[model samples]
Target: MTTTRPIQSGRRYRRIIYALIGVGIASLLGGMFLDYSLAGLVVYAVTAVGALALTLFLQFGSEIELQDEREREIGRRASDVTFQLFGYLGLVVFVAMFLLEATSQYTMTARAETLLYAYAVICLTWGGIYVVFRYRS
Candidate 1:
């Protein structure tokens, strides 16, 4: 397909980027809100819904022509970066929490929800950049 510039990316890629960011924020905030002061599997459910919404947007609203090779590659790299950061920090935090829980004889204050929020934030940040670059490309 013909793109505006001599590049394999287009504006639709940006649409996807923004949508993914919305998903990340929804996941992080929903997770935290339901955990810090609220409790239940509601946070998880909301995260799932957020993903679903993104799927719906991509399927219905996002034009398919924009996701060319360059945009896809960019998105892939973004996701990988986000995943690595999330994984490393998540592991460290969990490990530290466990150690503290053991040594201090007190349960860790931060729960699974906290972990999920932090992870979601990373996803949101990466997704935001993906969207921005998608448009700029």
Candidate 2:
């Protein structure tokens, strides 16, 4: 009798991501403790770009499919959950900022406004797409 083992591509990809995360964290700490802030930022930027490229490659460039049906479904569901969670989190932050500004006479920072605007745009885009798809279907 012959037996076959399942493909471990997903496991391999996950391991790579974890390793990159570890290295990124180590680089960040080393940069901070060594008083090389610029080096740390450079390291982080490089790591971010590398990670994005690696993820795109793993997700779309692989010759073999790594995710099974169940894995894909789970990923979809997890994405939805995070999307909703982050939307709510952004709203909460916006509201908190308003309250703080009103009570403490604090002005919103440019960074905070930029973040809020980005969050709002993303949420609106998501909502618009969802509505269009739901109505069309």
Which predicted model would earn the best lDDT? 2
Question: Which pairs of residues collide in model 2?
Answer: none
Look at candidate 1 and tell me the lDDT of residue 84: 87
lDDT at position 113, candidate 2: 92
User: What TM-score does candidate 1 get on C-alpha atoms?
Assistant: 0.42
Report the Cα lDDT for residue 115, model 1: 67
- Give a tens-digit lDDT track for model 1, residues 20-129: 66665665676677664233245445555766675577558855454668768999899789888867887687777678777986575556658667776876887798
For model 2, residues 1-137, the per-residue Cα lDDT tens digits are 96433347666776676677677778888999999877887887777677777878877887545577888899999999999898888889899899999998679999999998999899889989999999999
After superposing candidate 1, which stretches have Cα over 4 Å from the reference? 1-63, 110-137
Candidate 2, run of 10 with poorest lDDT: 2-11
